[model samples]
Target: MLTLKYFFEPNVTINYPFEKGPLSPRFRGEHALRRYPTGEERCIACKLCEAICPAQAITIEAEEREDGSRRTTRYDIDMTKCIYCGFCQEACPVDAIVEGPNFEFSTETHEELLYDKEKLLENGDRWESEIAENLRSESLYR
Candidate 1:
């Protein structure tokens, strides 16, 4: 019976690390900092995300600009504490923050994984193509 079952069934094991499986459109992987049309930071320091974060992993400091626009003076996401629930992304009105497709976020140090504004922006820039492709591949955003 076992031999018969094996003969009839297909291989269910995935060859991960070499042949990675596809992720769902709503998969919350990593966080990214988005940019504006003019290439400026997209976060408007609204504090909605901060308020909505159940993990309390997001830290945001704001300041008034010359144009009277409230901008984030300091923004940090403690990846160690983050549960990747996508609440921050959902709370963002301007879509400044997003949970990206890249999941290879291993780090040697705990502090290294705690992504700051610069690191988040770098991740956004590096994974922009992949993020765009993922978004385009799914109908969720449409």
Candidate 2:
């Protein structure tokens, strides 16, 4: 009876990497750092992201820039240690940090999982439109 039931069951698995799968609107995946419309970095070096990270995956160092603006000299996220609780983005006052839609960031080595400021910024640039749209939709409920 068990073998007969299995023989008639339809396959539920889809071809991934080609067919893809659906993701929720509020799905938290890779992280990114946003920028203002004026091309200035949105992060004020508030240390909120670092402080609020439950996994202690975030590390930040700030310095006064030449223009006297407080900027992060070093902002790194140890992705290996991240728990993806979405606390970092939620604690950000300026919405500088956001978790984007892309989740395909599989790395061959553990060292590659350490995300630096530049890499996060690059991710922001790459997924800005999607991130903004997600934020816009998310704000409607609040």
Off by over 4 Å in 1: 4-9, 133-142
Candidate 1 lDDT by residue in tens digits, 12-95: 888888888888777778899878657898899999999999999999999999998999989899988899888898788887
Clashes of 2: 0
Give the range where candidate 1 is weakest over 10 consecutive residues by summed lDDT. 133-142
User: How does each model score on TM-score?
Assistant: 0.87, 0.87
lDDT value for model 2:
0.92
Error of 1 at 20 (Å): 0.6
> Pairs clashing in candidate 1?
none
Residue 28: error of model 1 in Å? Answer: 0.4
lDDT of each: 0.84, 0.92
lDDT, candidate 2, residue 30?
Answer: 99
Q: How many clashing pairs does model 1 include?
A: 0
